[model samples]
Target: MRPRSLDEFAGQEHVVGEGSVLRRALDAGEVPSLILWGPPGSGKTTLAQLLSAQVGAAFEPVSATSAGVADLRRAVERARVRSRSSDTRTVLFIDEIHRFNKTQQDAVLPQVENGVVTLIGATTENPSFEVNSALLSRSRVVRLEALGDMQISALLDRALADTDRGLGSRAVELEDAARRRLIELSGGDARVALNALELAVMATSDTNGSARVGPEDIEGALQQPALLYDRAGDQHYWLISAFIKSVRDSDPDAAVYWLARMLEAGEDPMFVARRMVILAAEDVGIADPQALAVAVAAQQAAHFVGMPEGYLPLTEAALYLAVAPKSNSALRAYAAARADVAATLNQPVPLHLRNAVTSMERAMQFGAGYRYAHDQEGGLIEQQHLPDGLTGRRYYEPTDHGAEAAIADRLRAMRGVSPRVSYRDTPRPMIGSKRPRGQAFGDRTLHFEPHVPLIGGRRPNTSRSCGAGSPIPR
Candidate 1:
């Protein structure tokens, strides 16, 4: 049975409850063009109906799947006739409005804009992506949540007791456990709960006067309720979202369960594998360097082995990723670098770091004085590598998780030069030309003096060319 009034509406107190924006609008008879957004059987259509009736508008309902431009025009024409006869305007309720393509949706715009009808669109899909921007800008989106167990139970109770529209006329007795089973199978859907209840009542044979419906009878009626999944539709995205979140949150059990659900629901194994690979890099990252390797191997394994058997590698990878030490440092570092590039495009490379592949480049002081890092004592060098403006720009900030701890330590040791060169402690860029006297960049040393002692002994005054092709000044 459907709720006749806002008071009777079981859930969605956020939108239809007392003092809510929609409720306030309804009270004043100033219902704007609106979109009712929610999951299936969450009463999006019913809400639209209630809103139109409350505002005393002539309700003209149309299914977007079946109705085309001509049908829309006819509905508008009927509304015009209704307006002429009475003071009441029309409420054009478009069910599954998301199903309407951009061109089809645009066709209804003129009618809605002209106040010929107050458009009320109901959609299980997200309205932002599905509904046209022009239409969205003119409407208010009211999101409805899936009903909870308590709400579903209440609806079931109402169905069992309501005489007029419900199965109150039948000689049926619904047991407590049977009621719980119906609620579980409904998945917080009122329509589903009522339908399952009806099936259970109709199938049960009457014992003397009343037919007692047990959990077994309810289970039989439900017969493994089809999971709310469509491989190419909204549920696909929703399940993947949940799966990703579960892994990110480090819940191995949830990660495995969602993985199984997607596989069982005919989701592409390759798609799942791709997502795992991305998650490994984006979420687990260098904290667990093995995660990316595992994910990639899983993808290869799945492709090689094929379905049914392919699930083994996929599940193993998902579980491994879920338990790995988490770090988004690599992802964040890339984001920061991208922002910098966007902000300051085409920054020139430092002279010493530039390649001098040609003689012309060498003459221009390109690759002027870069030293060979391996020739140095500790395989450490002090050199200007980053573009001039980004001398001390620090992008990669490693967290002390898994293998990243050693990376963080090494970075601290290498980047640590002067007391002023503490890039790790302070996030600001080093602006001035003050270079650390004996600081090492990788392995080579930046010796301004003509003759600095070499690792073993100083070489004789011979013409020695650096890696950058700069001749040592004699």
Candidate 2:
């Protein structure tokens, strides 16, 4: 069978073809140590083969699941011998590279640095966490996207008409119905489509060798065992991606479902909790500031109490996060400030804000003109804290998605910040007796999910439940 080259490489036109990143790199004849990141059947391994073939580099391949440090050492040794003998570097291709732990991954660094081999690692998992940071830095990551429906259909069309590798002019025939079924079942995986088509043909063939392929003949073929990861494998990370997206999407029920998936996968409860903690701070920032506290507390409590028992805290945390008024304003604030610091690393800190922690330091004109907020009874001292040239720059703009409505007003009044608040300055509270006037205490707050089943299953009195029809169970 003829191997597919760059000219024949289907899909990912963004990265391949003339004037593209890969094309340019291949033309240069020495591409960076690369990590191809994508879903299965997105041609990660194929790309590796293509890379080696195009560049005239001998490819040495290893499977991460089966290859140990010993196997790695031998590959390294072989590469060394080949490089010295041919005076040409080899491409050490490692598939499922995330399976290699830190120590094994560390061994490849020196080889990569020495140019004895160009490390071409393939992993479905995000390299930032799975691959060692140093090794990742040495490689340029190329992300492959799942083929769209159009691409999948086009591939199927080619398979149906091509007589060589594909089953064109075969004893079996593929109807449009059969084609649609094949494409749908492939889940954008090319290997899956080819394998399924092959299976359906075999199933339809008679003892005398006459066969016909149709929707009926391929029904069982649809259920054929996967050619790829049987269990979730690294694809389980994709579930976490879905979960994070759901949480970000703000559908509590959907978030709960993703949590259930991660939990069932035996994903570390603490790790899940940690992400929740991060999400609470990163996604549900000052708009629902209490969520970060709740998430962090749940993580600590779950850790301290230790599982089965720990699940309650986790569940509660998820629920709180799901229902919390979501905001990324605080996250944006920090990011903006960090960007400013990075852009102006050499800019001097204004003198007034500098520490007067020592008398000698104080004598060096430190803390000369600082205004203390505490000195004012209201804790409302108006003073500039930014660099002299960078004053009145607004970094945090609050959205009224949740608690931010009130926060939007308060900060607007306090800092002269003009915010595009999405909701009214004062939204009616759930426990609305006009919000019990004067100095609200933080203690004894009532909270509940709107769609959650009422406590003890009691539908409230129609007229007496505070002008509300249903007494939502707390």
Candidate 3:
């Protein structure tokens, strides 16, 4: 049953409660052109009707999904005629107002501006994004929230007891368990709860002239819970946001719960997979380097397998990311470097770090004093790799978590700073380096000796050449 007055309204106390702005305005017979924004079954249409009744105004209703510019003009003409002939105010209620296009919404703008009809636009979307700015600016937007369990229960009770508008005259009894199940399935939508309750009562066989609706009856009436999700609406962004935040907060349970909610509600699995990939890089960076690989693999697996089975890999990746060691050092390092790039003048690369590809370039000393790390002891040499303007600047600050702890120690030693522990004992082979079997740098022997040539069946020269013959610096 729809609320006939503000007093009968079960939820949204903040909007129309005693001493509230809309309540006071209605009491004063001043109904402003309004935008009622909220989730479905939140009493938007009922509130509009009540507002018109309170002010003794004629109510004219239209559905934006079906109404066009012609329908709007006709309604405005009727209101204009009524206003002149009988001085009666008309409340033009447009349900699903966000469905109207720019042209259709624009047609109502002049009518509202000139006070031909007091427009009451009801939308299940954020009016700011869906409604045209001109119309939104002219209307006082009032946000309605979903009804809570207590509010829904109160409404259900009213329906069962009120003989005039509800099912009270049918001698129907609703079991407590059935009521709870109905409320849960409704997802805080009062209209769904009331309709399902009515169905349950009607479907139950009479027991001695009175029908008793139990949990089974309620479940049968509502075959499955309708999830309150709109893929192109606020729910889409909100669910994904919650899922990412839960993973970032390292709550595996919450992460998986939100993941299941999205998948069950028909969200694009690819969309969820993409966001997870981003989260793995942004939130679970170098602290556990494998996190990025896992997220990417999950995305590929989900795409390859397609949904139903795709959710398996998605769930696995969500758990992996949630429990993995986290570090934002990579994100912060890039941000710090970006700030320098923006703040400083465009600086030239150091001459030694540049490639001397041409003879003229070699004469200009492009590769003047660049040291070859392969020839140096420990394959590490003290060098100025940064530009002259950024001689001592540091970007990457590895954290002491998971595999990054070892990296941080190695970096400290590379920078000639005393590390918390020795890292030289575990020297690994440099990437793409193929040293001869007996070659040694200082006392550390090369553990990885390739049997075949590294590139094109020719042994790569491992010398201190810095001119044209040397490989270009990565």
Q: Which number leads on lDDT? A: 3
Q: Per-residue CA lDDT of candidate 2, range 1-474, in tens?
A: 123787766688887868997789899996679999888888888888888988888899999999999998899899888878987668999999999999999989998988888999998888887899999999998898877778777776676667788666665567889877777778788777777777888888787654667876666887754433313455566667777777877778888887776766467788788889889988888878789899999999989887768877988888788777778877766665565554445556788899889999899989998988767644555567777644555557677877786665455445422222221122212222333222221233222212322223333344332212222222
Pairs clashing in candidate 1? 379-443, 380-442, 380-443, 381-440, 381-441, 381-442, 381-443, 382-440, 382-441
> lDDT tens string, model 1, 135-180?
9998998888889999998898888788898867767788999988
Best of the candidates, TM-score: 3
TM-score for candidate 1: 0.82
Using TM-score as the measure, name the better of candidate 2 and candidate 3: 3
Model 3 alpha-carbon miss at residue 359, Å: 1.9
Given candidate 1, what's the lDDT at residue 385?
A: 75
> What overall lDDT, based on C-alpha atoms, would model 2 receive against the true structure?
0.73
Steric overlap count per candidate: 9, 1, 0
Off by over 4 Å in 3: 207-209, 417-474
lDDT (Cα atoms) of all candidates against the true structure: 0.81, 0.73, 0.82
lDDT of 2 at 410: 53
Q: Whole-model lDDT, candidate 3?
A: 0.82
- The residue ranges of model 1 lying beyond 4 angstroms of the native Cα positions read 207-209, 230-238, 415-474
